[model samples]
Target: MNAFIYFPVYLVLKSEEEYAVYYLPTDFQSPELFVPRKPLSDQAKRAGWQGFLYDLSKVPQGAFIRIV
Candidate 1:
């Protein structure tokens, strides 16, 4: 069996009228990992911090993470 890592991501949409954010969990490891090239934008960087805080509040204890 293959193991997968699910990363919680925040999708931020900015429009002239308003800004919206959505939280989603995505499987980080898969056969299709190398094909797509989706990089984070500057706005994402700002939103990421907020997203992280949100995820941390909800994630259960003892979750393993590696920092590089």
Candidate 2:
């Protein structure tokens, strides 16, 4: 069996863009996954930033597995 690890992510908003910042442990490894989705809307992107703080509070730190 394979073991899985999770890293912390911070979503920062710059203007109307949402950026995902990943926080990893010293031994953390990056995943090799690809996304198959369309892009996000301008409004949705802005909202993502505005709600980042709230979302972080609810989710476990370093437990963010994925983002789209």
Candidate 3:
């Protein structure tokens, strides 16, 4: 089986003085990636980014896994 889903790549910055990271729209990059699909939290929905959620458990391994 073949399956695909789209997700926005976030450019997170680690705080120089803290362990926290920051996610901002101004910082982003284009990269091919595959990850588990899950529901977006209510807080994330307010971010206004577009994405889709799909169960990929049935998809065969190596079908979408990317190796660098």
Candidate 4:
């Protein structure tokens, strides 16, 4: 059997009406960057100091919302 572990990505607010996506790979020092190629959800607007999880492959509907 094959085992798999899924990690979390984040939708962080950079500034007003602006945002950036960060992929926090396990044990990695610096987070990988992913461009927000599409329109974001309302959740993104609410992303404060504690950014929300934007897990992609793990979400049943291919993610709760699109950020990239």
Best model per TM-score: 1
Worst 10 residues of 3 by lDDT: 22-31
Quality of model 2 by C-alpha lDDT: 0.39
Stronger candidate by lDDT (1 vs 2): 1
Clashing pairs in 2: 8-62
Q: Between 2 and 3, whose lDDT is larger?
A: 2
Q: After best superposition, candidate 1 residue 4: deviation in angstroms?
A: 2.1
Question: Which residue pairs clash in candidate 4?
Answer: none
Error of 2 at 65 (Å): 15
Measure candidate 1: CA RMSD.
14.1
What CA root-mean-square deviation does each model show from the true structure?
A: 14.1, 12.6, 11.2, 15.0
Runs in model 1 with CA error above 4 Å?
1-3, 26-68
- What does the lDDT come to for candidate 1? 0.43
lDDT by residue for model 1 (1-68), tens:
12445556565778898777755445432334323334446678444332112334344343323221
Cα error, residue 9 of model 4, in Å, equals: 4.6
Ranking by lDDT: 1, 4, 2, 3
In candidate 2, how many Å is residue 55 off? 15
Tens digits of lDDT, candidate 2, 1-68: 02435444444445566655444342333333212244455678454332111223434455543343
TM-score of each: 0.34, 0.21, 0.21, 0.25
Q: Estimate the TM-score for candidate 1.
A: 0.34
